[model samples]
Target: MMTRVVVIGAGPAGLVAAIRLAEGGARVALLNKGTGGLQLGQGTLDILGYGPDRVERPLDALAGFAEAHPGHPYGVLPADLVARSANYLRDLVGPALLVGDAASNLQLPTAVGAVRPTALASPSMTAGACVDGARFVIVGLRQLKDFYPELVVGNLVRTDLPGGGRLQARAAMLDLPAREGEIDSTGLTYARALDDPAYRKRFAQAVKAVVEPGETVGLPAVLGLDDHNAWSEVAEAIGAPVFEIPLPPPSVPGMRLNRALTARAKAAGVRVVPGSKVTGFRASGGAVDSVQLATAGGDRDFVADAFVLATGGFESGALTADSYHNVHESVFDLPLRRPEGHLVHGDYWGDPQPLFTIGVEVDEQMLVRHPGGDPVYTNLYAAGGILAGATRWQEKSGEGIAVASAVRAADSILAAAATATDQGAAS
Candidate 1:
């Protein structure tokens, strides 16, 4: 008999866990309340970008980072597992699509032209790495209101790279051929238009005319949505190396990543249940039997042999706070580990707030633990932002922790299932 597992949330963690479970021969059901965070995030995988200071070597810094911050998710996650998870995600997303590794952090230019460090990035953004003597022409479409090439160039010219480099950047704006009744276009519209081979050729010509010698072209991340080759095609047409600068929320690169992972999950035989909010769950004898989902008619129960909760933190409503500053986990009402005194203090963006560090505690195996360090449910595990200690945004370890913990949780479930089969045979 196949082991049935239910994974909650559709973020990177949940999707990864579901895919691993299904690939391990388990019947997996992935549930999500709404869309995942990928659409609002950069497609790059950030693994420990900062350890108080900028981290050049992410894998090498893991042990020190874990020691500095006790009870952090990295404290339990082995470095080898973290490295393996990076490879696993790259393989799952396809080597040709996702590039980079955990060995070193790449300083990629953000939408504002400020440097952002990431361990893994798409091929479209790899050429944008801010290195010594790197010259760039930040290009923007006149019709695209989201991107500002002048602003990007202004920032890039003043900013210094993490690895001791200065940037020389210029700005250019070109008018793209407008469709019927179209004056301004969203990233999606521009992405779809670029998918056409003919449109890409014309677009490349326009970009090439504005480019100078020894300057790599930097365009807004609207190259393609459905087509991954759009960036390369444009680069080929322009006859120059080009890279993408990710735009604000509702990101095209992010959408491409989400679509790719979701598609891979489905292809791995995982059943995806979308738009279902998990309101409650049934647990007894320290094991979860089923979870309740809110429906149009009424609440429905989803039964499974095991469960993995990857529901995001405060951002996704998985964790909420009341007027008195009492925070609570939405689904299981699990206990949270919060800092003493005020939950938040100091500047909003300066120092990491204590409140942001509050989350459910999990064992090394990714199982949620009670206040006294006992598993709440033997068959339940937690991953991603929900099981937190370090402030992910502060450290830039969000994707790394999510992927590694999800892999650990799925591996634990598979091992448990195998042990059960062996016990049954022995009996």
Candidate 2:
């Protein structure tokens, strides 16, 4: 019989875990309460951007990073596993769609013109990698209210490029294809408009008119919605290298990535059940036998041989804090490892709050562990934001932790299944 696994949450960690399990010949069911947190991100995978300072080479810094932060998720995972996890995601998303390797971090510009270090980025944003003496023409759509080319340029011109030197930047505003009566639009709306070939051609012409010689074009990340080739097509039409600057929520690039991964999971024979919240579970013999999902009609039970919890941290309500400042894990009520004393500090921008680092403790195999150092449940594993100890926002290691931990959990389950099958054959 096929090994059955139930993965909770639909975020990057859960989705990747489900896909990996299915690929390992397990019947996987991915359950989620709603859309995952991908749409709220930049869609770039950041391994280790900063270790107090900017990290130029993430892979090279992994060992020291892990040693310095022994409580972090990377401490339990091998650096090679982290590298393999990133490669797996790059391959799964197709090399063309998701570019870059673990060799070094790309310095990409954000909407606010701040340079962010990321290990893997889409082709649409890779060209904008910050370099010394680089010239940029930031283009903004008049209809898109979210982006301001002037603001981006103003910040870029003031900020020094990584490694050394400075940047030369200018702002340009162009009207997106005129809407019937709409004056203001969103990133998604602009992306849909750019999906049309004629519209992209006209838009490219408008950009071309403003761009100067030897200048790379930077635009809000709204190149395309349904068309994955829209960015390349626009670049071709303009006869210049164009890159995208990620905006706030409702990010087009994030949506594109989420769509691609979800589709790939389906294609891998993973059963994806969205809007299904796991309310409870049935456990016995030191293992989780099944999980119950809240349904419209009634509570539904999903039986599985193993389970994975990647419901995320405070942002996703997987970890909650009470008025007294005591934190609790929502599902399974697992014990969380917290800081020594105060969770929060007075400085908002100085250092990450201790509260953000609180999460369930997991063993080397990604299985949730008891305070005494034993597995809480033999069949239950945890990954992603829920298995913390790192200040992800401060370190820029959220995506890396998610992918690496998910891969670890899935591989452990697969290895156990293979061993069981071999033993039965021998018997």
Clashes of each: 0, 0
Candidate 2 RMSD to the correct structure = 1.2
lDDT of 1 by residue, 1-427 (tens): 6899999999989999999999999999999988887787788788899999999999999999999988889998988999999889998988556899788999899888788889999999999999889999999988886789999999988887777869898999998843546778898888888888888888999999999988899999989888899999899888889999999988888898899999999999998989979999999888999999998889989999999999989999999999899999999999888877898777876778988888989888888988548998999899998976878877889989999999999999999999999999999
TM-score to native of every candidate shown: 0.98, 0.98
- Clashing residue pairs found in predicted model 1: none
Where does candidate 1 have its weakest 10-residue lDDT segment?
175-184
Model 1, stretches more than 4 Å misplaced?
Answer: none
| Cα RMSD to the true fold for all candidates | 1.2, 1.2
**Per-residue accuracy of model 2 over 1-427 as CA lDDT, tens digit each:** 5899999998889999999999999999999998997887788888999997999999889889989887889998777999999999999988656899876999998888888999999899998988888889999988887789988889888887778888889999986644556788888888888888888888889999998889999999999987989999989888899999999998888898899999999999999999877888889999999989998989999999899999999999999999889999987888888888899899988878889989989999999997538998999999898986898878999889999999999999999889888999999
- Residue 156 lDDT (model 2): 82
Q: Cα lDDT for residue 214, model 1?
A: 88
